[model samples]
Target: MIVIQAKLIFLNQQDKQIVLDLMRRWSSCMKFAYKRLLEGYDRKTLKRDLQGTFDLNSRYVDDAIMKARGVLESSRQLDNNPKKVIFGGRDLFGKLQKRHINGKEYQKLKTKWQERRKGNLYSRGDKSKKGNLNTRIEVKENGTFLRINVGERKYVYARIEAGYKKNKRREELLQEIAESNIPYSVELKLKNGNIYAYFAIEEEYPEIKITKEKGVIGIDINAHPGNISWTEVDEKGNLISYGNIPMPELASGSKDKKEYFRWQYAHEIVKIAKEKGKAIVIEKLDIKEKGKRGDFSGRKSRRIRHSFSYKSLLSKIKTLAKREGIEVIEVNPSYTSIIGMLKYAPQYMITKDVAAAYVIARRGLGLQEKIPDNYIKFLNALTVDELEELREHVKKTVRNKHIKKKHLREINKAMEFLQSLESKPGRVLEPLDGTSFSAYDFWRVLKVAVVTPLSPEKVKRDFSVLKELLIQGKWGGP
Candidate 1:
């Protein structure tokens, strides 16, 4: 089922008071419990570090008062020292952000409480000193919120209140979340200006089919402004078109590459739909939930992630493809990159303004040395084999802006190395440099050794010929 989850962020003052109040109450309760525990204290009967256990009682509000205490005592012994306790320690849930959490905040608090602690009820710093106590804490639904002080350099949780914008923005933050992949979607819109955005999710369903003949789409992931993967399916769903856009540059990932990848991919879907009535097969994705990552990295990452409309483009593709009578199916696109496009021809987009750089490189494109690989894939003076491969993948993925310098340097090295064609009768020496260089042109160009640093692959085929003839003797290093 298609589902969407949104997070709204806001900041205000009223919420801060609620946080401090709860802390104060929690601290008093802990002090009372400590007095009782001391009365019942028996070195053998006493759980352990008496002080740490009491502090843990209030912090782990949701924990079994008994379980929390037991854990605290055990934890105390682990450190073999008593931690300092604080009364409602420093300010954590400042009045600024009131609504910065989700439905699962309470559970999160309980879980965090069980971890090692250095301070009192609130996750704090020194053994005795109160930490900002940045552990998670569950808040009451009557607008109660929980937050931490960013850098007091401690572990703690302070319960507060969820305010207007802060409350709306709670779900907006997330960290490294799960994956979400869809066939064709509307790409997210980005504003160079304001944080505001406006768009309704566009949804549709199309007939899906399974192809008997599976195809493979090779992908060239690039780290540029955006990403583009190559994709194509034959008459029988056998991926055909052997090219696509390079990976895109993401502040944190490969978005541009994916954008162009889908754009070019959709064109193919439309084309195929018009030809043979077939369904487009892709992975079903849920951008919302997958981006939630159980609340890591805070809400900012999630908010910004939603900003890129990868789905928007997909929606358009579906519309156009459906009009052409094409069916769409979703296969798991998870790990498609590492899998080397097992059943699909991944597409990478070149310039919308011009053909991909590889196309130019194949034809012996010339350029100044300073240009990045976005401009040149093959060194202007590369050997024929290298040039051919460059046209397909390497050239596009690499950012050899220093074309003149890097290009000539690579060529000279190759030439000198290729000339040292020597093989000893008893043993063979592998070309150190070429072993791990871009042989997207030459499959398995890496001796399998240079390619994998930890676990090296043995040559299943003859290699002395290749090793001695080229890439050895300081051509360069892996």
Candidate 2:
């Protein structure tokens, strides 16, 4: 899908003011709907209440309620002490110009909000507003022209430019509309004393081929401002290409500069995919949820999380790729960082971020993630007698006066299991008391031994590597 915006070229100033008046009304409706949402009104109740509050049609009120709710939800997710979502009086115009809601248009607006700042509902602008009701714009295809509804009983007719024909080499909105069998969505926006109509053009493309012959480009998004690590892999998941694309500091300094940099970076990535004839693979992330729950811990973590616009980056790349007829694949993000750090990074002699990207690409290609040889070699070299000695050492280290009886029992059971496993190498031990000793548990034992004189730093490191390997599905079940 590609979006093309054309200036709404009203015949006179009176025609423009007529639409601006409706925008003000839209602003009022959004404020009203926002207040209702703050009072915890659900959609059903809000829709009913909006009918009595706003002098607009039921559909207009419904869309306003929806937009207001979205604004509040977005603010809460991004802001630590989020301010109330309010569209002020300085600018009260938007692109939501149709009565019936358009899914792609709504998504586009939502993306804009997601990419916006703490207190603002929309991107900060002198002429633009947050709650532009889209119900006012309507588009219909005439013989060789297009008719657009600007305001109440007002219409603007536009002729199709000769250059924007179906056989044109470039992707034009009119050409896409002519070829598309489905309905098209239109957006009306007020910017710098001009009315602009944006048309979302969806085109049908063939399904992307997912086979061993073609490779995948995996991208690992980082919180470090503008750092995008990527790797290309073949059908069997062998590494083909890998590099980090460094962007300028995406800090909260200048919005326009940041936007320009992001645009350039996304195109650079898309260019690589287009040239290589590969599918783009990215980790499916929910940064808002991660940030809200305090999952991203540490001092600089919050700053990094807030600053890094992973969603926006992905959104731009996806949009650009669609324009070029390229495919994008999203994969699960579990342990890509940890597994990358422990296994792929050192083995491939690349940064952990790049390694993670490589792993993500392999996952997209439906291949298994692997641990490094050095770690595997260390695990294979471990003797059963040595495990017994290590267990006994761990027991001695933890034999403190303050140690609880329950913990002692757990240690005893863990040690006994190790001894049993010495003789019964392939035996699958039953989970003890509805709990299991993961590789982390083994690492903890080694750590305890290290605290005493029983074990050394090298032993702890070796066991840590084994722990990671075990958790990574190296030895079957943890």
Candidate 3:
């Protein structure tokens, strides 16, 4: 759908403050009016009542309504829905003359309302409108105009600029986005900077996917992204290799909290998947297990398990999935990660060459059907392009997750620390949680099956010689 987002900037702080104060007062008056006047309470009649109540001179309430309507129509959601009315916070005091305003002289002592931060509340008996409440005003779809009277004069800063037509300016910009095109609920992010508005579009469907299965699909959710492992059985109920995908959190750190984009991201993906006829598979976490994420395991629980919002997100995803008649399976996660898809199967069960190739090849690719034997030769002969691209994608993805930019450097440094003990045949290394790694345990793990034996005495004797160079403060860096 055609979504229009606008950012309003007050020319100066004083003007901004003035506009903000006025909006607070007007918002209260507005709520009071609506609570009293809106009985039939439906949008069509509400817009008419609000527009007629406000004074208009040099006024253009109609313009704002028209702009919003224009967007709704292009989105094709305006049918039977009333248009929206939003009041952009205003500024413009020092720049104005009495004539420019409604000819009202500046009062000797005037009070204004301001916004409340934290947990402050706006009450009726306050000295000013109190800036205590910030309210969003809405009118049902008709793509109508909005008005605010400045002594009977109204101005429109944000309004519909274009509508879609065969030759319309906005038609090319829309690019097949419409309410009908998106058949389920999802969020669309249209942004400039600083200001973002969220619109919820929900379409109810009877089923999640067109697949023939009626049984549950098991999922294994993870710290970075979620993973699903479900056994697909044949008509005879024979087990099929489970399927899994790493579902990463879509929001980036540099984004402001107020932006709140991931709900929309998750919503959109589920919506599209449903439309494409795929059952949604997700993990059900035990409350206590999910709560203590930091205790998951040795390497992962300590280092990579801290991203929040996954628990809540899974709930929302499942709710939407159920609405679409999709089956969601929650399987016991024991032995899931360490023994996953045959391709990514760990070194103990699968040989090293096979495991390395699988991790490198399928890190970014999704679950897939088996490749023919000849395809392996084709992949082996393919230039180093594949590995390089895979690293680039992983680096970019991880960077956006807000992990410290120096993380890889630190990890490499730690690896070097462990490597030093390679000469110390029986030594082990173990980094504490948050530390790169400990020296004692990890070094021991590496001390095995050496084609050529190394001297343990070399490490005990020479390791102290390199300690200073090995560390960057308490953290290690190569």
Candidate No. with top lDDT: 2
Give one digit per residue, the lDDT tens place, for model 3 in 1-478. 3343323333345543443444443444344333433233444454555555543211122232333344444445535322232222123233232354333333311111122111111111111321111211112122211111233333322222234343332321211122123321111111221212222233345654533253323233344333322333332332333444434433344221211333343455456446545444454455445233455643433323355445545655565566566655443333223223222332123322222223322221223323223322332232333324433444655533433333333334434544553434543222444544442323222221110012211111122222232221121222
> TM-score per candidate, in order?
0.27, 0.44, 0.32
TM-score of 3: 0.32
lDDT scores in order: 0.32, 0.55, 0.32
List candidate 2 stretches off by more than 4 Å.
Answer: 1-213, 291-304, 377-478
Residue-level error in angstroms, candidate 3, position 442: 25
* Backbone clash tally (model 2): 9
For model 2 the local lDDT of residue 2 reads: 57
Q: In model 2, what is the error at residue 168, expressed in angstroms?
A: 33
Clashing pairs in 2: 96-133, 96-134, 97-134, 97-135, 97-136, 97-137, 98-134, 98-135, 99-135
Model 3 accuracy (lDDT, Cα) = 0.32
Best by TM-score: 2
- Writing each residue's lDDT as its tens digit, candidate 1 over 262-301 gives 4454565456445443334443344454433555332333
Ranking by TM-score: 2, 3, 1
